[model samples]
Target: MACYRVVLIPVDENWTPASPDDVPPQPPQPNERLLETEDFFSAVREAIQFNQQTWSERKGRWAVVCEVGCPGKTWPGLRICTPLRYKIASIWWPPGWEPNSPLDMPLCICRTHGTLQEDQLSYEQALATIQALNQQAMDRASTMWYVMLAVENEPVSRTISYDPAGLQTTVEIRRLHVAQPAGGGHGDCSHCPARSLDCSMVAPA
Candidate 1:
């Protein structure tokens, strides 16, 4: 299994503008950089695969809940960081319908500050923790949640929404790590053991 860390971002649904036309344009998060198109796509694909693997391994035989392959490619939630508007807008997607504000755009970011991560947290641990956080936060229409994934040894960062459907603990780490040569979808990543994703920016523990 690849080792990685993640930063969690909370979406604020209450942001409002004067009118629909005045709605903030979607773009990359402020101070943060955009992962290349291929990198971003690889992250998304790997994330979906990771989530599916952990959930199936822990829970045993679950159905897919995300529209990952949807023709429209919908986001898991509506709330987003404000600075991430244009980054998302750069892609072909439909405006997510959010509650209470006509000017509310479907983007899933607010600000790029105060990112939290626990490098020790594994795929199952992160998923379980985020689910709990969402449940405690409750069903709020104004906010969308995200988990930025950093492969244990990979340098690139990618974002995923928090899934509220479950809050399961008790993960059994079926994957046993052994030293392997460096290689992944993005080619050789000398930083850490090769997994599905490459490592260009991950800090070793």
Candidate 2:
């Protein structure tokens, strides 16, 4: 089986006013990046197929697990899942009535059914969970989360139909390194950028 490293970018919820007249800011959307180790495509395809089969008959709540590390020390990451329940109400129909019309039936059903189970935690909570998992992985193996980008290949001419040259695939990944916070403080910048006025600068006058 191939190996792949997935990195998910947490959505930023904290918003500040861009201008006095502007409306309150909204949270940014979460971005997901997947990195493959030489055989990412095959591994990801297998993972998805396995998950789909597991989800079909699995009862109660569901969680997605990602295996990390080699045989000596392997860790399984968890993500809580919740089933989607849709409720469609109409004024003309009775309460809790099902849509008989084919047009309305499609709309009544939620589209995001087979997707991964979603967590109730906020953006910050999700980020914290990911960070903790990454730290655990780092402690076990020297590997860190890396974002996968598009692949590049050499050009091939159509005139030479069976030519075996000029065909190459290059996978790009943005590596993220884990390091100790500056000053060993709480990672938050509460006292950063110290003002000179607060410093002991005696006036010449």
Candidate 3:
């Protein structure tokens, strides 16, 4: 298991825009940077340079470090520092619709900051946390929520043909919500509006 720390730096200049756009601004997208370690200040400086020189934008003023991947041992929860957007699958993905295998089903209920890991938090929690936080206070970065999760280390085996470096077996650490409510596709929502056409809790006829 590996613990990766990455800083999610914003690309917009004004932290608080005058007005909200018709569609809310999207969060930063995570990349292989989670696996790379340069340094804190160095990473931030690079982000600033990239924004200024590459994109011609004077952004990257704020950044928050997020721990990605899994730890060796079991942990109760993980804190997500970046601003995340809560989302659910549309009616297009009607209940019981498994586009892929169970392991590969698309996200139905999840909290995300466009990162590699899906930070699962109820919509109520996500809304309240973002509202309570003072968007202007960079010092309150630590005042984020710790999303409860269940971590498992599974062993996997694979066959390799190359003899020079034959390493095909490894242990994978999987993290998931301890007990995601069945409501999204299984039953009534624990906390949400009454089932409607657009409601995620609605089941297929």
Candidate 4:
């Protein structure tokens, strides 16, 4: 099974990162309506389930552990940021789980020591890179080049036919291309002398 760490925990504004010497947080009070608490399993679960909206809203900010060959998450890359599935009863995990351990809860289950930021920074970088490449192709050859973003020589992001900013969404996995004419099966790749394919994804600075 993959290891998980708690990334988003609903806490008070004044809450500070817990230290080893500090006492563990107490159960939610009768009036703290943020996360509606059931019989507590772990401190993290209490934060996740106590409120209906607190965790639901945070689902948008989910993160993933960066794979070795995989482009680090955050950029406007193709890999979809999916919400992890979890059952409340499963929160009562076996021994060895600590406060900072990867949470197995239903928001994000990180496999790495931690997770990349959920802000889709990688996608933004990828978009910017492709826009530059598109401009280069237009200027160099006066033709539109399909810019493909790659990581470890593999194209993990979408194959863009034109400008990246015109895209409706970034997590596109399939090759977004134009419909080929009869008897011409993606002939542009073989026929277009000005065509080029390149990766725009780069590690965060």
Best by lDDT: 3
- Please write out the lDDT profile of model 3 over residues 35-119, one tens digit for every residue: 2342322332343334333233423433333334422121212223222233222112224423211112223434432322355
Which sections of candidate 1 miss by over 4 Å? 1-37, 41-106, 139-146, 152-205
lDDT of 2: 0.25
Tens-digit lDDT track of model 1 for 84-172? 11101111112232222221222322233333453444444544544444333335532443333323121122344445886544432
- Name the lDDT value of residue 173 in candidate 4: 41
Task: Sort every candidate by TM-score, greatest first.
Answer: 1, 4, 3, 2
Question: Alpha carbon lDDT of residue 116, candidate 2?
Answer: 22
List per-prediction Cα lDDT, in the order shown: 0.26, 0.25, 0.30, 0.26
Q: Which residue pairs collide, candidate 2?
A: 81-117
Query: Model 4, 158-177: lDDT tens per residue?
Result: 54364667755345342111
Q: For candidate 2, lDDT tens digit of each residue in 1-205?
A: 4234433222223433232111122212213433334343333343233324322342211121122342211122311111111121111211232322112211112122221213233223333443454345435642222111111111111122333686755543222111111112112223334322232211110
| Model 1 weakest 10-residue run by lDDT | 82-91
* Per-structure clash totals for the candidates: 23, 1, 0, 19
Model 2, position 96, has a per-residue lDDT of: 35
